[model samples]
Target: MPIKFEIGDIVHLKKNHPCGGNIFEIMRIGMDFRLRCSTCNKQLWLERTEVERRLRKHFRNDEEIKS
Candidate 1:
């Protein structure tokens, strides 16, 4: 099954960037996904297929989305 994520959901990515962070925010969704690094503020676009493969986990609570 494909993993699903929603806007404002906090997620951990499969790989960590050089900044030593793997967390990202699901800013946009569609044929492509737009993500923002939780630690470095870096943003990038990824294919939905690729994102599904790399999604590590979804936030269990809404605390992170409050901001």
Candidate 2:
């Protein structure tokens, strides 16, 4: 099954970013996704398929969604 992600979801990638951060926050999602790096606060745009392939894990805590 394809992974389902929502805006504000926190995700860990299979590889670290150039800034050495593996964590990213989902800012937007569509055919493409916008992500913000956890450590550097840098933003990136990636295709949905690429993001799905690179995703290692995702956090969708109920508490986070409520905030």
Candidate 3:
């Protein structure tokens, strides 16, 4: 099944940031995904194609937390 991520879902990218973190949070989802670095609070935009290609894993789902 294809992995689907939504806003507020935490994810780990394929590569670590210069700040030594690989984790990010989904801020927006569309043609491009907007992400905020979990460690440094830096915001970045990644194309959906690139996101699917570079996404390493999904961590926490906001929906799951409410249940």
Candidate 4:
């Protein structure tokens, strides 16, 4: 089964962002997803498939969630 995501979730991506941040918060979800980097506070837009593929971890309220 596919992973489920919520709007306010914080996630760690498999790859480091150019800004050297891997932590992000979900801003929008659908065919495309909008994420804001926790370190740089920069927003990114990515496809749902890409988001899932790059997802390394999930978090809520600063705690990690096991998949």
Candidate 5:
């Protein structure tokens, strides 16, 4: 099964970010994705494929979504 994503969803990536956090919030989705680091509040633009590949888990409305 594939993971579904929506704006404002929180995601845990497979690897930690440079800020030492693995969590990020989804900001925008379309041709690319905009994700904000949960720790540093840093926003990054990434391709959809990259986001999907890096994603480990996802949450919506504070509830984890099983994939």
Candidate 6:
């Protein structure tokens, strides 16, 4: 099944970002997705398929607090 995502959701990418962070926040979603790197605060736009392929895991705010 396709993963459900929302704005503000935190996601970990399978590969580390060039900025040395794997964590990102979902900024916008559609045919394309906008992500902001957690460490460097850089923004990136990627296709939904690419994002899904690279997705490692996702954590909501409550879930993040618990971890």
Which structure among the candidates has the greatest lDDT?
Answer: 4
Model 5: CA > 4 A from native: none
Which should have the higher lDDT, number 1 or number 4?
Answer: 4
- Return whichever of 2 and 6 wins on lDDT: 6
- lDDT values, one for every candidate: 0.78, 0.86, 0.80, 0.90, 0.89, 0.87
Give the C-alpha miss distance for residue 37 in model 3, angstroms: 0.4
Q: Which stretches of model 2 miss by more than 4 angstroms?
A: 62-67
* Per-residue lDDT of model 2, residues 37-62, tens digit only: 99999999999888888887778973
What local lDDT does model 4 show for residue 32? 91
Which one wins by TM-score: 1 or 5? 5
Q: Which digits, one per residue and each the tens of the lDDT, describe model 3 over residues 1-67?
A: 4467778888877988789888899999988899999999999998988877787777664433321
State TM-scores per candidate.
0.77, 0.86, 0.79, 0.87, 0.90, 0.87
Give the lDDT of residue 38 in candidate 5: 92
Is 3 or 6 the stronger prediction by lDDT?
Answer: 6
lDDT of 1 by residue, 1-67 (tens): 5555678778777988678889888899888999899899998898988887787677835543221
Pairs in clash, predicted candidate 6: none
lDDT of 6 at 40: 97
Ranking by lDDT: 4, 5, 6, 2, 3, 1
Per-residue lDDT of candidate 4, residues 1-65 (tens digit): 66788899999999998999998999999889999999999999999889889988998877788
For model 5, how does the per-residue alpha-carbon lDDT over 1-67 read when each residue is reduced to its tens digit? 4456899999999988898999999999976999999999999998888888988888999998977
In terms of TM-score, which candidate is stronger, 2 or 4?
4
Lowest summed lDDT window (length 10), candidate 3 = 58-67
What is the TM-score of candidate 3?
Answer: 0.79
